[model samples]
Target: MRADRLVSLVLLLRQHGRLSATALSRELEVSTRTVLRDIEALSAAGVPVYAERGRHGGFALLPGFQSELTGLNHDEALALLVAGSRRGAQAFGLGSALASAMRKVVDALPESHRATAAGAVQRLLIDPETDLLARRTDTEEVPDTVVTEVRRAVFAGHKLRIHYAAADQAPKWRTVDPIGLVTVRGQGYLLATRSGSDRTYRLSRILAAKQLAEPAQRPDRVDLDRAWQERSTRFRTGGDQVTVLARVNPSRRGDLVGTALAVRAEEEADADGWLRMELTFQDSRHAEWALWQLATNAEVVAPQWLRTSLRDRAAALATCYGVSS
Candidate 1:
């Protein structure tokens, strides 16, 4: 513990030239005496750590002492700069600190690599995703903050109380035992347990949240990765792919073929001047949904069930819209 405190004290002095014993103790989570002892140990190890016992003094490193990181190689220096830049130089809470830290890393790099790194930034324009990374100048997102806190709670085995927002229902507050954080494409999701049932809450829909220091016993649910995989597969396998064969009015053949959904059509001038069309969909639901749009323009000839469903839906719609069904 003393060695750990000593290392932390050294780093603190390197980052900050002077720190009071109380400050160092609080930072290292140790007693004031332990902080003094760590300073003595650093001195014993030729760390140039000095202590001043007075109303205005505590611990200070000798002037011109170089940080251990100051001797980094060119690539290491550039990497440090890249890491520092991620904290954001124009964003709140980290702008000035990140800028200063990045400057130090760039300045420490070998003269050869420094120009190359600078030139790369100048030559490249990283057009930030306007929709994904969009942020207001001052207003912070509560959902985004909740997502971050939920992730930390999941890792630390803690519970979270959240106010959740749903489009079709009233906003409600609930406690969730955080299980895992999933990133789908670019959106974040939280899988949690509520009242002994597993559920997923989209991070963007969480209105507010706070992590509870106390942890509830997390359930031995199915492995999250496998569960998600199975869920996805089940959804994709829900229905069989079917082909819809339709007879289109010959006058509509060119218009039908012009559409992306029109798969294939055979043009044979029947007595009624109609052409036959075929389209494929992963499930009947898609075919039915599309058929509702093409009423009168297309007539379903195969898959009697789909045709019946479409006709029933159309009749219902017609009744609801005050048309003679």
Candidate 2:
């Protein structure tokens, strides 16, 4: 309460310039004696506070007085309130500081303006989607330290020395330059340039990583933005343009169009509301993945060889599992 009142007194003096003892006491919810004592305290603490006796007399800060509250305009003041409130509630070590800072600003406002600023703070608050964040972060919780270093390396164009473990091998250390970092459904990937080859490293596979002091330089800049385009162009320029015709159920049409592997070239609807889509796949692996992803919602209608290969692979998998074929 002492701290709050002291800041409030500073704010009142900074904003109102001059007010009578009656007005100051009423605004601060204290007596005239308390207001006088606060003024003496401010003076003793080297604050340029003084009482002026006139028609417009109360308490005022010196004209040259500079506080964080002094320089803020309307937009900055509102932004500060909104950001501080959001940070205070969501992040640690912010709420008390923000509340204290807000009190200081409020104390500087004229008696008339204080209510509006306080009301704005009350009305605007941020509540993030707790359920969605829970579902996302639950599946994969990468160490915060690894994420921090990866972000730093990506931005600074530095190579990373990392201990990479894979399904087939024991963990081993390698130096790779990070191109981009992406997080999907709580799974993080580092699209990296490794020894002149492009690859995507799962964050889960990374045992430990640190940004190297030496900077990474790419020879003939591989545009990370154009990675999909590069893959597409490679397919277009390659031999044997394989075409796929698929009949997709209406309920699953969204899944087809939205998926990265399947690029729909044409779409047609039937009386039954099912969608027949002409989807292009870059290669056999791309098509197989898309078909498996779509499951019972789609069936291949063209390219006999590719269809036969899918069946053959399925049969082989069934054989391995000792299922009746």
TM-score of each: 0.42, 0.44
Give candidate 1 regions above 4 Å deviation: 1-109, 122-144, 219-227, 234-325
| Local error of candidate 1 at residue 48 (angstroms) | 21
Model 1 compared with the native: what TM-score? 0.42
Per residue, candidate 2 scores C-alpha lDDT tens digits across 9-115 of 77766656777778878777789899888888878988888878777766788896865534444323443654533432212112333444555657667758877
| Model 1 worst lDDT window (10 residues) | 87-96
lDDT of 1 at 263: 73
lDDT of each: 0.65, 0.67
Per-residue error for 286 in candidate 1, Å, reads: 7.6
